[model samples]
Target chain A: MTSLMTPKYATVKSAFWGGVREAASVPMLIMGASFLGFGSMIKDINWSISLAIFTTLSTWALPGQIAMAEMAASGAPLLAIVLAVGFINARLLPMSATLLPHVRHPRFPGWAYYGVAMLIAATSWVGTLRRLPDLRQDQKMPFLLGYGLLLYCGSPLFTMAGYWLSGSVPLPVTLALVFINPLYFMLLFLQDLKDPGRILAVLFGAVLGPITFLYSPDWTLVITGLVAGTLAWYLDGVLKARRGTDES
Target chain B: MNPELYNPVWVITLAAAVSYASRGLGVALSGKLNPEGSVVEWITCVTYALMAGMVVRMLALPIGALVHTPDWVRFIAVLVGLLVFFIIRKNVGAGVLAGSLFLMFLMW
Candidate 1:
């Protein structure tokens, strides 16, 4: 939810409407298509529809869920698979925390965001950040809820379609579907970079994580986020202060 | 049984429970932490930095399907997407779509 104090913004109704508009626009389509591919993967691998839907409802984090599903398909141990997926998603805690305070209604103190957040994903988080800054706090949650529900319902259908496509689809086409998941999110971040340090952070994190993963896959994200995040913050602060001094 | 062929219902159930509990943990912690405070402010910055790092990491070093795309191509697509996103007033859907389609068209 965004701060209502902002001078100009959308009403709760309008914000949710924007969410609908955004969800249907491009991200949803990409997600729908890719999830269709994922569904195909699920079915081809013989995971039940129930399991796939359960993944949607339960984990909700598409990247991690996909990792879990695909790794499991390859005969990875349940614990190891879950751990790997969980490790990837550990960034969500920070993602959620950074996002929640910016939107939690100061007046509506009793509202519980847990249930709503339980359904959140990397898609919705990126989606909401893209919209909610100019909306009221109250409007923020509803916008996310509406958008998430629409996207959520599509998962099973895509899964069913993907399962069908997996068998007959040519290898190149199949590769395109698989690529959509990460590509979808990556492009969103590129658009959202306002701070120069974030640009640096992205470069460092991206470069370091893979290099580190080659040596130790498990600790790559964890180590990269801490070191890289701190560096980004420090750099941003330094640059901002320098700008402030010049202005003064 | 080849584990992939059949997941015991318990595995699904346990995974769901754990996942939900992790989120609930975030909400509970949020209740205690004041968002406007200095530490929390710092944490928020850290979160953004971390998320940025993660995103960059994914583009720079993808695990599965993304690894196949050449690095320079991926980087250009992302940059193009960012340029479009800002040009279009920070529309996330447009930014990501343009970037992806750029890569898709070139690669395809």
Candidate 2:
């Protein structure tokens, strides 16, 4: 017998509203602008407007959606297109794993957990990570759900808006709109530099990512991540061990 | 190639399915794995590496409309954003706005 009056559930309402408030601000603006650019890009590439909105509604990953739209427009093979987009979105695997342990609760059913997991992306993942440390366990899930719901629903509307306004919108504005997400993520990465392992990983990955892209565009992400990440992890371990030995 | 293969409906559907499948698989694994272990630490590092790789690629070799903008302009914008981010005590929103608006101003 679950009671709504339990202290566990006490923070849920406030956490949800807090999430809504947070999403309604910077994250919402950023996502809307990014999706607006995505919609305009779809229009420019001669993809159907419905398809743009559909991709927003379904995948919600901007990079993967763009890859699919662009590749399909070039008449790339369907299997290849699927594989490329899948690889681009493969980052979500670790991202989901990193965030799930913080938010998963026995109070929520499995389906609800999976549903929220589907909505996790760059914006929500980073946002939740930054905020979760301050929130209670119960608050975390509702906050993420609230934030994800707003972002997921708001994106399609902005996508359609961008598609309709594509012609009238200046090229510079559209470019800036598209630039918002990457810039936001990069800035967030800068904030993440406090962690030594992550700092090394970012530094190594930054150098390797473009170099590998020149060699093999399709596998650049996975290759760079695995190699750079492993290197950083090993280096961090060595440093930690040496520091421990010195302390002893 | 089947004409239907390139259909917008099929393309969007399949792409969504593939993207969701990766994320779903992660969720399924999350329950079984111990988050505090070295494996999770490695996964977290990989996630950071992946994000860093993608962000760097976007800044260095952007596609579509961003391709037209000069590379230095983008570089300066990011530099200025980082500068402001630290100056403002790591306020992400202000830094992002500073950088984005700076790029728009340069292009304008």
Candidate 3:
């Protein structure tokens, strides 16, 4: 008889396949729609289909990919393009680091981290973090690999679809497709508002983001994130201390 | 060298390298940081805030075709989605579907 401590899956193959199955749901549609928009945008700018597919494979982050396209089109220098893409994707650093603890296992190969790190898009990061706790420790890494692989491979196809269907699709529908990504993210954040620090971060970001964007559109996300997050962290700390004192 | 003069292949190659570097650096750093420590908590908070900022920017000041829709229409769709989300016990997929359809309806 299997104990409660036993993992749901007996092997890595099962876990990985399970992850692929899990990903063939709403999250997959959200990512598909985003890439579809991206494919069309690249076509609109007359960029090659191969290059567009490469961006999905290599950069793997939507915002950075979009920034690279826009910057390149405007004839921004190479260094400028590099810096813009780097800063836009800096969130991946913290997100990957946070995820490491949850997914690490001794049986998992060390070299695989570098390869899998390429899959750390906002959707994968959030989905993995949210789901890992419910999974057995041994299952986490393989599951992520399965989930990431399916999306990573399937995204290029979606991009190609968007590229071919660009002018044929109605403009308003294409716009709505792009809008789904952010709308999904907003609702997901709302669903996860049980923690004070998280709640404060979202509230503060919602307030400070647009105001800061007016002055520095390129750096607004990082700057607003730093200031609002730090303030929320500090305030949450204070609230925790007060609660502790009251309990005492 | 004039920054304006560059090859497209080099641009894609360099951009990919820069993007991957951020993720690789995080993977390297993750080994050293204590998961339960204050540092991780701080990073978590920052990540959340960063995501929130991205979401707000996309909604309030969208680019491309989304720019055509009136601001109030987008905001109303969000409000409607939120209502449906709460009414249905925080179903994320439902919320997104409701909001997207509503936006399409308003913009249609």
**Candidates 2 and 3 compared by DockQ, better number:** 2
Task: For candidate 1, write residues A83-112 as lDDT tens digits.
Answer: 545545654665566566656875445446
Taking the tens digit of each residue's C-alpha lDDT, what string does model 2 give over A1-248?
32332223356787887787778988898778778767877876777788888889889998778767655654667776776677667767767877888897789888886788888998888877877766787788988888888898899999998887766767776666666667877787787687788899889989988898788666666677788988998898898889999999
| Every candidate's chain B TM-score | 0.68, 0.75, 0.73
Which of the numbered candidates is closest to the native, going by highest TM-score? 3
Give the Å shift of residue A222 in candidate 3.
3.2
Ranking by DockQ: 2, 3, 1
Q: What TM-score, to 2 decimal places, does chain A of model 2 have?
A: 0.72
**lDDT of each residue in B1-108, candidate 2, tens digit only:** 443455788888998998898788878887575656666567667766766777788789975567878999999988888899899999887887788788888888
- Residue A78 lDDT in model 1? 65
User: CA lDDT of each candidate?
Assistant: 0.62, 0.78, 0.78
Q: What does candidate 3's lDDT look like per residue over A1-248, in tens digits?
A: 32454336778789898878878887788788778867876776678899899888888887778767755664666766677567657767777877887888887789888778988888788766767777888899988988888888889998898888766777666666666667777887888799898899888988888787677665666677788888998998999999999999
Among the candidates, what TM-score does chain A have in each?
Answer: 0.66, 0.72, 0.73
CA shift of B95, model 1, Å: 6.3
Q: How accurate is candidate 3 locally (lDDT)?
A: 0.78
TM-score versus the correct structure, for each prediction: 0.64, 0.77, 0.78
